[model samples]
Structure formats: C-alpha cells, structure tokens
Target: MNISEQQIWDLTNQAIDKLGANASPDMIRDYVEKEIANRHGGSLPTEKFEGRVIITAFGINKPGIVAKITGSLAEMEIDLQDISQKIMQNFFTLIMIVDITSSPRNLKEVQEELARVGKELTIKIYAQHEDIFQYMFRI
Candidate 1:
C-alpha cells in the first residue's frame, strides 16, 4: 500500500475509534499506544540503565536551559545521581547521570525529553565509560 502521512494517521484514528467502541478506555489507550510503538519499528531500543547523559549547552546558552534540563528530570522524579561540567568557548558541557525509576519500565521518555531540550541548545548525551573505547574501536 502507498502509505502516506494522511493515510497512516487516518488508519490510526480508525483503530482508536474501533477499540474505544469495543473495549474500555484503558483498552483503547493500549491499542493506540501499541499502534504508535509498532510504527517506530516493532520495539524501542534497550536503554542503558546505568550510564551518563552528557549534554553540552551552547548558542547564547539561553536563560532557562539549565533549569529546564534539571527541572524536567525533577518532574519525572528521576534522580540526578551525578554531574560534571566545564565552560569552554562560551559553552557549558554538563554530563549528568540519572537513576531512572524502574516502575516506568523504560528510559525512552527521559531520552525523548532530553532530545527536545537539545533542539534548543548544543546538547548531546554520550555513555561515558573507560571500557567504551576498548569495546568500540579496540584501538
């Protein structure tokens, strides 16, 4: 099928309606969620539970970038386990590691939130570790 944006969206809406009519609200929600997740390629990546999210903030650095970054995590109740930073070339590279809650059963939400903030500033998150180099390039 020649699936266009409009077609995909229409199908999703129809699915939502069918589920709503046949099942409870929770069931519809689950159906819509499953449909959405399937669109992202079956299943999401397995996030590293314990790793650092290194963000480099720049571009006038804005005003509330720092607070927004920390605040979002705070609202999610994700614990800021550790942080490191340095200012160079008028930029702040904040490498933070957060202890995400197990109840959520996923780190994608936290990653998505970080990605949204990155669009506003020069931000990046890398899994920093001594063995990363040895495992990757083996150079």
Candidate 2:
C-alpha cells in the first residue's frame, strides 16, 4: 500500500509512545511494520535486504544526536529516509528511520559503529530492521 509521510509520522509517534527513549531498536521498528500491516493493507514485502533502520539516540536531541548519528551513518554509506527528533530535559531523542538501500554494514555492525558514538556522547542507541516487527507482537 502507498504510504504517506503524515501517516508514517503518526505511526512513528505511536511507536514512540510504546518505545520510549531507553527502548531497543527492534521495538520501534516492529511498531512500524505491525501498524502498517494491521491497517489491513495486507503484508508489504520487505524488499530483499533493502529495509529501514530505525535509530533511536537519546540526549542532545536537537541537532547533536541527529548530526552525530546521521554523520556516522553517512560514513558507513547508510542513507536517511525519515526522522523524528524529540528533546526532553537534559536529553534528546532522535528517531531516525533510514533506508538500507546502500548499507555497507549489517544491522549489528551498524549498531556497533553507533555504540562508539554513544559511548562518547553517553547516548544510548537501539537499531533494528523491518523484519523484527513480525516477532514483536507474535503469539
């Protein structure tokens, strides 16, 4: 089904509600898939390894976290497709939904690279792909 940015944003917001700042990458990623599919729009084939990466970085929410993560992803040749930035007291949350069209590293590797940045900035990251969604709310 064709997806709109607003709808995606709304879905993203819903995910944020469930997956706070401390949540793992897999958590939010699953929401996007479940919500999209549960719309009764039917299952959307998760194209090859071509998936989306949702990066949740907490602290310095405005540009700092976003810049750092995006910059790091760029270094890894990962492209950003959509993003949501939420800032709270002394903490910034960057929910970046990225396109894995040209990801040079796997999700775990990408997470590893991100860990370095988080270690430096004290920001925690949770990274995951669309497939993780299937198991999120499974029986």
Candidate 2 lDDT over 1-139, as tens digits, reads 4788998889878877878887787877777778777785577434345678777777554446667777899998888888887657857777888876687566777878999988877878888775576568665
Off by over 4 Å in 1: 1-60, 102-105, 125-139
lDDT of 1 by residue, 1-139 (tens): 2358986788678776776557777776677667656776785435545443333344443466668788877876766777766677766566676566432434666667677767655565433332454578786
Model 2 TM-score is 0.55
Which stretches of model 2 miss by more than 4 angstroms?
1-49, 60-63, 133-139
Q: Candidate 2 lDDT (Cα, whole model)?
A: 0.75
Residue pairs of candidate 2 with colliding backbone atoms: 25-126, 59-92, 61-92
Best-matching candidate per lDDT: 2
Give lDDT: candidate 1, residue 23.
Answer: 76
